[model samples]
Target: MNEYLPLATLLRLLAVLTLTLAPHVGHLPPWVSALIAGLIVWRGLTAYRQWRMPGTMVKIALALLAFVGVLVHFDGRLGGQNAGTTLLCVMTALKLLEFKGRRDVMVLIFLMYFMLLTHFLFSQEMWTVAYLFVCVLAVTAVLIECQHRGALSPRITLRKGGIMVLQALPLMVLLFVLFPRIPGPLWGLPEDSAAARSGLPDQMAPGDISRLIESDEVAFRVEFHGPVPPPSARYWRGPVFDHFDGRAWRDSVPTFASGLSSRLELLGEPVSYAIMLESQRGRWLFALDMPAARSLPDDAFIGREGQLLARKPVTERRRYELTSYMQYRLAPELDEHARKRYLRLPPDFNPRTRTLAATLRTHYTDDEALVTAVLRMFHEQPFVYTLRPPPLGRHSVDEFLFDTRRGFCEHYAGAFSFLMRAAGIPARVVTGYQGGQHNVFGDYYVVRQSDAHAWAEVWIENRGWVRVDPTAAVSPQRIEQSIEAALDAAEGLPGHLAARTRLRFYLEARWEWLNGRWNALVLSYGPELQQRFLERLGLDDLRDTILALTVLGTSILAFMGVLTLRQFAPEPVRDAALREWQRLTRRLARAGLPQRPGEGPRDYAARVAAVHPEWAQAIHHITQLYVRMRYLDDPDPAGQNALVDAVRAFKPRSARRRSWIRS
Candidate 1:
């Protein structure tokens, strides 16, 4: 089949394969991409130049080399998602070298489809969906071209394939609406499902969140039931860190005590909203500060430290509804053990910070007053709020507070928490996102990784856990507006979050709104949503749903099958000129001057004119008219009419009459 395969068709296949494999280039190893590219070029050259394919030994050597390369690149484990995808890509490229038969082409096409499916493992955004659709259409067109006995125009082939896909849309919709949806993703490897996501970490050090501030990736999106909380109150709580080990703060083992409800005091009007949280691959979930215990997601609870957590890591995008109180008191009465736990700090670290805390404590004996004094110091001093803070030494808090006043939210929060602990106050660092950008077009807020923040949560005698953002004291604009506004002009914001011109901002807003709609309407369709939709459609019973699905699905398929058959069914003769030409040929055949099988109108006319010289002029005239009207580009309308009229009026002479004329 390789010998007979058209260069055009081979090129088409290669083009589709390239499109299918392009998205993976970012994640696949550089060598793999380079190798695949080289092989594709080699295949194209081999087809075009008619070069011989690699020998069996050469093929074996290439395969073994690829195998070894993949094994070495993946640390000898070929079982995981990355390894398997790499192997598939390499094998697909290798398959190009041995394009022996139609079966091989079919195998390659199927592999392309599989590769296209793997794209969803990384992203299911609207652009990805549209790209995959185009790739599918291209692949389908190539598949159709492969089955043709003769060359067809690329446009015609593509149109036919597109028609087939459009005809199948009804069935696709039926299946999508009625098919039973599993709880999680339909296709994914558990081990690598959340590997590509970036968000808050469980631990917070001097620059942990400051580094996060550089990423534009979305952490989650929130659609509030009412007005969104003010910027100062929009602290999406994530992990709570009570254990500060010198340079970093880490979360203690979450205590799922039954008395969590008793410890949390809900106040003010409850803010009802739903969060479409992106996968962070962590057990902790983020909600507005002080999420109510009663309004928690299933298999999730508020930890003793007031951090919302789930039983399992968020391996996929999850939408959960919760009611949180912007104003709430937590753990009003702190026990001795808990107080000590929150106050504990690594010894012999940040001696200067400890000394400063002791000095501030003597000045202001009242805990609340002392807190205010530290905040005042931060506000009055020349502490700079910047993303590019200098590197911290072993005494990070000490250095940030004294030596270099430049630091991010984490730095300020860490120093404040350390000072509070040293001054005999129960204080801990609370890490989460602080501010969200509102997408007015979508009526939702987009919380990005850039919004990741840390603040001090001090346990006052009667106030319980109070939120204290020392960074706000240093740079109040960070809390009031966005990080973009808070940072100096010298500091750059994430690409997506950077300020834009009015037109560009509008365009970005529209695009984000479209993506939000896609996520809500398409990606959020899970088992529970499917059930609700079916119920609304009066498909309450499982049997009824299945029955309806089967019936509707079969009907759609049957309709599509009939349409397909009609499309492939032979077309009737419709051209008047061609019909007249056929009639003329039939008349000649009856006179025993039949047109030979492989004879064109001109050739048959020439043969007849030679046989009967008396009819030569007339035969030549008819042939000329027919050829011009039938074959030439945009023949004159008068010429077509003349051919039809001439064929109708002219009658051929019989063999006897021709012989008589000859004698």
Candidate 2:
């Protein structure tokens, strides 16, 4: 067994296994990856040294330790996606320790294929898919090597495996195109599978938005049916926080007022657009401030605060069509409940901010005049729009407004909302994404986490809740251009933005465009898209889809059958001596005496000679030449030719039926 399975084959299998498990490292626990690496190193060393494999008891003990470690690490919750995947990965690595035979190798290869699929559960990005494909090819090559006899090179195995994969492409494409597309599970994934998203949070603390500002990960993508909205107008509203607890601004009871059909008195022509929202693991959806969608999914609805919310958390990419009026009035007739909530603030939170608001209130008579005064103060104040800001004391808003005066959008929005509430005007902090980069190639706006912005919305007597962004006052360029443009040249950008040359930036933008295409064309392919695709194929309904699938599947099978027949067709024996020897045996059977089954040439010849002694010399001589040519190696071509000639020329007469056959 050791002789058959070479060190090179083992190393190649280990290399492929490493690639299959590499992507999982980031998702699984750190110890899991480390343990896997350690096991691989140990296995490789053992194979290189030709050492005896681990015994059954040792392998069983190690497996138990791995199982216990996984359970303890995940706190005994071994059912969900991450936990199950971690356990599978740990066990798979341990399987390498007891690599006994071909059966064990086959099991590992099958498990590796399953592990590759789990990677898509975490991320379906184009780069990840491409990387997984490479891993698949490598694993397939190792599988081929397992079945193959003799010492073949890795390159040959890889070539054969690649050919096999290419041949399977036709069937894969047929299945992908014709397969019935169904929606995801109605109940959604397991609770633990729905990992927390990294974008906006429902609760906004002092440095929540600041921390998000560093991330370049996309929040969602929007494709405008008409003109793309200007950066100033693209305020995708998310969570509305009216309850302030001195340190963090939180959502009030009214914020959860979704599932209720509320009509908005839209004033202007609605901007029709489709938003491909990334799963944020929360119900809150981002849209224009005054959004009005004709038909929302059963799980989704527009909240009373004009915020979109889902009945359940979003665990997959959701593409919903919405018509939003950038210039529209929302909740003009404000109720007392909402009014009181917006104006409600902790009593002893920020004394100085309240005093300043009072002074401004005394100076400005009307609500509009007070709003203008507040805007003027924000514009005139030396408030720096920076990600890093000085830590605030208990009075966060007062410290930010009076002392620190340096913070991100959260600080400005919090301070402005406090000033509004202090001046007796109902206000709330609106947290959502601000500007988005418009991709020229794909014609979609990519809103990123760094674009996350917070602003205050004040409800006046007649105008309702007016959108106000104090960050714009401090850094207008942040809205007009981008976050990078707004940051000071001396302060520098984060890793994603910093050290990016023009060429690198261009390449990155192009890569984003490709990723956007993948998201739209591949990942977004669901029931509706499948139906549309079927319509093109004249398979509109379920009956038609099934029929078409049957026809195509049958056609594929028929074609495969023909290829299979061609692949395994019998070929004539190329050995001249063997072919001639087979002919000699047939001629002897034509006589009265025939060779019995499982009879060797030497035995058969002796039996034939006893029955017909007249051909004894020829039979004995032929058997000797045949055995030497067939069983033993003969380099002389003339020797094989002589054997063939002798067998064909020697025609033995039948012992008893020769005269009767002649008559």
Q: Which candidate number maximizes TM-score?
A: 1
Q: Please give the range of 10 consecutive residues that has the lowest summed lDDT in model 1.
A: 187-196
Predictions in order: lDDT: 0.84, 0.82
Candidate 2 lDDT, tens digit per residue, 237-292?
89888889888998767566663344366777778888888767678878886776
Off by over 4 Å in 1: 188-191, 194-196, 255-259, 568-663
Per-residue lDDT over 281-395 for candidate 1, one digit per residue giving the tens place of the 0 to 100 score: 6777899987887789877988777778887677767789999999988889988888888889888999998899899888999999999999999999989988888898888
Show pairs that collide, candidate 1.
Answer: none
Poorest 10 consecutive residues by lDDT, candidate 2 = 185-194
How many clashes does each candidate structure show, in the order listed?
0, 0
